[model samples]
Target: MNLRKVGSKTNVLMMLFCILFLTSACGSTVSNNATAETAVATSSSEEKTETVKKTEPVKVVWWHSMSGGLGEAVDKLVADFNSSQENVQVEAVFQGTYDESLNKLKAAMDSDSSPALMQVYEIGSRFMIDTDAVTPVQTFIDQEKYDISSLEANILGYYTFDNQLYSMPFNTSNPILYYNKDAFKAAGLDPENPPKTYEELAVAAKALTSEGQTGASFAIYGWFIEQLLANQGVEFINNGNGRTTPATSSLLNSEASVATLTWWKQMLDDKSMMNLGRKTDDTKKAFAAGQIAMTLDSTASLRGIVSSADGKFEVGTGFLPKPEGSSDGGVVVGGASLWIMNNKSQEEQQGAWEFIKFLAEPATQAYWHVNTGYFPITQKAYDEQIVKDNLTAYPQFQTAIDQLHQTKLNLATQGAVMGVFPEARQLTETAIEEVLNDSKSPQEALDDAAKAISSKIEEYNLTVK
Candidate 1:
């Protein structure tokens, strides 16, 4: 019994030593294995995180003013761009109408949060430049050695200054004469030969007006006034329409502009033309409802007009009529252009440039032109098969293409590039309204408008300087 007890105690002591020594070594091995596994897991996780980061897209914001059908086309183009590449993505934000968009953009500029890309109306070119917050499109074109030889000269001229392209012309349009074929036939006028001059238009309007229908209608917008001046080779503002230097004053009270207003007022007085009072949509509606026989509107309206007149009557388009006895000058380009913001990063700027380049492609231009009725800014777009098919399907669009091709690349046709052009346009609209209301004569109203615009121009120039 004593021997067994001693053996048991010795065995217990031996077991305790073995337990202590093995516990330390085993615990250390287990700790090392756990650390190695965690290291591998972290390394794998980091690799996955980097892979996800690499696959993420660079988002570029595009603030635009397009809405309705035009807006849909813009969305399609953006989607196409996003789907075509894995590196960059474009997000289009509708910023209301052009004027509203410009106002918002001004506010955004102050906060240094302007979009990477923006679509500014042609009249905003000078103002955009005055801000000095835009990266001239020429910079990228030159840097990339991009070939813009296919671009329309007239469209390019509108956005060019100091021998450099400040923006890329995107959705370009020109005002044109839209007439109802049935109305023309009923009035005993040749629908094939639409009005080519204001005099002819007046004659046609006299015949076309009867009963509850007016012969023609147009909004009291200054754009038509500008087109009239440009068609007569009249400068809208001094300093070569602000292309050579900053414009100090406007030529709103020029004889040509005065004559144009007088003619328009007379048409209103004769009851042959409907004065839609600044509401462009009223004119469009009136024309579509067959309340008016002819209307002056942008080529961009072709799609809407045609769709509205689908079964009502046939639609005919022609160049915007010139004043009687005026020589063949040309119509100014009327549309917006794409501008890249200067405050963005280099990668953002490069991404914007890529988008601009993509839009400038002939196929894209053709698609835009066919879908939105905007004039193609590139000649190659006209050569595209889709564009040719569209021209064949709707011969009405051919008129716009022909008219754009006929436009002379001159300062008058290039249009005014004044910093206060938007305000100047408003003044013109107000002057027209005053004349229509018989509150002032055309010359008197235009004189007052010219003075007001001149004052604003002076004030704006001083502030910018």
Candidate 2:
């Protein structure tokens, strides 16, 4: 093709058009790239800020049921824990008694403010598992490959289900007979040799009952009945004391229960053991005041009882009495345990786990054991100096530890579990009253109580399923 020669002005104009076209395209591309880079920078900055916001110590709320002297010990533990670490801070709130604390937990289940750590009574184990509200302690144990061998095996057995440890044992105790040693001596009974059988106990009670003092006064509490039954090596409910499966009925109306109730009735009929209603506090006070020679209470109550009886009489501790010819049985651990709630942040849950492990440590448990009458959850705690000093100073507490070690681990000794344990306790209490008041015979009362509890268990199973 033939081309025409252009003038300089025309060439300059064409060149200018080309330059303008290139400039616009390059500017648009640069603007888009800059926008993308700016967005990336902004996103990165936001992420860094979010991380910084989470750097503060994880604060965990713990709800407990300890009160009075026990409450003081709990406060000290929380204080020590807070001071010992900076990564986690714990605040313990004493909600109330075990029942009250459990009720509050149920009410707060749907709220975001639920407690990260909860102290629940042993009976509440089934309810807690059914709630799906807990991050099993097994999760943390597996994640860390923790050595739980040091923990008391009997205690571990109760909280373990389906090969999973649901919670950590905090304060473990069992029922023991707290008696006035002076009364024993006065009654011509050997102060050193406490009653080991129900017949001996009945005899001692009869001898101790004279003048202003009664021989014994057991609180019409159902827990004692449960313990007595377990002491005689009987299952409180079916399905291996509710360990193998959710129990559908109560075995309360058995020969063991009937005999025990009859004994209590006989004691009342003979005017030896007095009924002080359903509250344990009444019996505890009566024992402390020297109005009653003996009373059945938790080992956890030893410190309080000793202090209460100070300068009045010598407080003596003895193993729980069982029926004659019953060679096998042990008192079940009857204290509360610590549970980590699953509805909390992962960081909070880890913090709770740390607190739990700290409580299970030798020194901490030793301090707990000496200050309160609860047994240490770990056997290593016995190596601590405080525990030794405790045994040396207050030999009464040794009875509980001895009783624990001597106990043969069996289904009956491991204790019972039920979703409606608290209700069952009430029903049993009512039965005790009926028998004591002669309104119903022991067999009739126990049968009625068992039937009622079985109905409740069935209802509970239905809902949980």
Candidate 3:
């Protein structure tokens, strides 16, 4: 109160002091606010960096042989897996047909540039195992303590050796008889019941054959021959189909095989069966176009055949016809399995395993089975709604399921596990062609093929040993 009465100079000094004090207080408040803001920004930046690190995905290359609908389904599965987690991304590359893919893989191995994962056919399994270029699926299972109890026993049995799973079974299929229901009905044959024996099939073919249509057609592939041999309880190679030990010889000229080839030759001679040569799609087309009454192909072909038919004619399926009077035999599983390349980094291997595990889940398997006509590798997949709906829509698929369930697991049914199986199959195919073209008798052609396979097996066994 007495400041007013003070001198003008004193008043000015007091006013200056008040202004300086307020300015200093405001500066301190601003500095504290700036420091707090900087701390918050730094914390937010650190959090974002951590998030980026956690979301970084491990990329894996998967070389496969699937094509057509199966290829599309695989791409979908990979996309789903990529979206499911930020930990891994799979690149699915189509490497041509199964045989071509295997050849390419061998070439890649030679260059030491193989993919992180590969899909190898059943025939290529022994060779893949022998090369030691891949890690067993069981290794990862053991490391993760994964429960594989949901896997289908029959499908799993095909890939197991020495009580260990070498590869993850995917897109598994078995051979079955696909026929035109309208053609059967037109020929006065029972469409509801298809042939179950080779002799009966011949009878039906004779009835179904006409001026423009053949009763049956089949690709001159070794797979059906192998299936026939298995159905007759004939092992393709010695040493329990190469399961007990490495095979040194082939049983291509066994009595059962000779009889099967003879029957096939007789069918061709009678003009009841059309030989489509080695191209599988040719036979499939012929059957789908109603030019042939029936064809024998893998269950995997069901989707393609049905799509190709496209309401032109109803399709029917049955178990592959057994040899007359044969017993205690069954069809072997076909299709490919997934293998993890051994030489990749640990992260890549683990990533590949994770992708494979995702594929084996019930939901993925169900989706795959419904989309592509391959049987699911896991039994639980059948319980999924998609699979149930598909089965209801296409009951023909049930024939394959029933056939698989009816199959007796044994050495013959498990198929030949020879390292030279590819060569053996080639020789067998050659033998069939020889007989079909009248170049040689069934026994003569088979005997020659057997001799050649024996040599090949001996060579392969010696080298591997």
Candidate 4:
């Protein structure tokens, strides 16, 4: 009886030992599983963190000079782009006129207040490059092997320096002869055959003049003078219109320029053209009101002018007039380009390029063309259905595209560049006034203006270097 009891106790002890061992092993397995789960959770958390960091949108501040209706169009474009993607969010700030916007940019150069991107007038290109504050668009172009073959070459030429594209043309236009078709018809002139030369333009202007209306009202705008000179295949600055080398002197007093001012002054003296002062806005109003029959203005003004004259008269567009017998010249691209500022962060700069690409897209350019009168800067934009429809609705706008295409690709047509272009323009405007007001002969006015600009060019060249 004692032996049986001892054997039962030993068996019971063995079973208890086995139970403890199994319990310890199970506890260890559960502990290991929990630890593995914690590791997995930590890894997943990091993956999500990395994804968030990678996908963060870059905020780019874009400063622009667009105002009034044009400003609204700019806002709509930015809004549409912002809604279409998550990679970039653009904030477009209206900085005022081209000169004013450029002034602000100059002031903000060394501060955090500088914009990641900016819209600079075509004339600001030299100054922009001289400032060393730009990342040439050619950089991104080469990095991505991006296809820019679809862009307008003449438009691109204005922004290119040293065979490199410095900026992206956003809104581009050329000066055109905007006239009242109804006025032409009333004056016994063919509305379809608008003036194509300075001599012809003068005759048409006088013919269009009537009891209540003057034939034309050209604003004393220096841009128009620059355009007229370029139209005659004349260079505005030496060094190949500042394309071959940095411009060292102003060619503002070329024979073509003197002749151009003389012709314009003759029109004023003959009472065939009105001196509506320097503001294009005033000239536009007078034209819209039927007080003036013809005007020289940017194609960018087409939409507004057409709308303004909606019920009054039909608007007609013609190529910018050249000198009589002149056969080898074209209009330089007017309007502005979008430039990526060098002071911005790489991420922000990339975002700026993305936005620029979006703007240059066929669809976007078409939208811009219809909403604004500026050229789309892309030939593909003409293929867009909206562009087709808009062209059908307002056939007059076709003249601008035609004019742009017909322009011979020369340095003269590509336009001039200089660091002191804005000042030079002011000087040129003053020269035009001097001629128009009988204060100075066209030759004398231009000679003085030229001398002053050459000095400016020299001073600018020295400072930039």
Question: Clash pairs of candidate 2?
Answer: none
Q: Candidate 3 residues 29-65, lDDT tens each? A: 5466568777888999999999888776888999998
lDDT of 1 by residue, 1-465 (tens): 122323577775654555567677765655565687778889999999999888767779999999988899999999999999988899999999999999999899956568999999998988899899999999998997999998888889989898999999998889989999999999999989999988999999999999989999889999989999999888999998877888888899999988898888888899998887898889999999999999989888888888899999999998888887887678888889999999998889889999998898899998999999898888998889999898888889888888888988888898888888889999999999999999999999999999999999999999998
For residue 378, what is the lDDT in candidate 4?
88
Worst 10 residues of 4 by lDDT: 1-10
- Name the better of 1 and 4 by lDDT: 4
| TM-scores of the models, in the order given | 0.88, 0.87, 0.90, 0.89
**How do the candidates rank by TM-score, highest first?**
3, 4, 1, 2
lDDT string, candidate 4, 1-465, tens digits = 122323587765654565467677765654665687778889999999999878868999999998888899999999999999988999999998999999999999989999999999999999999999999999999999999999999899888888899999998989899999999999999999999999999999999888999999899999998888888888999999989989888888888888888899898888989998999999999999999999989888888889999999899999999988875889999889999999989999999999999999999999999988889988999999999999998898899889999999889999999999999999999999989999999889999999999999999989987
Better of 3 and 4 by lDDT: 4
What is candidate 1's CA lDDT for residue 91? 96
Cα lDDT, model 4, residue 316: 92
lDDT of 2 by residue, 1-465 (tens): 011333587865664565477677765754665677778889999999999777888899999999988899999999999999888999999999999999999999979878999999999999999999999999999999999988888778778888899999898998999999999999999998989989999999999999999999999999999999888889999999998888999999999999999998999999998989888999999998889998999998888899898998999989999998996888899889999999999999999999998898999999998888889999999999988988887889889988888788888888899999999999999999999998999999999999999999999999998
The model with the greater lDDT, 1 or 3, is 1
Q: What is the lDDT of residue 291 in candidate 3?
A: 89
lDDT of 2: 0.91
Return whichever of 1 and 3 wins on TM-score.
Answer: 3
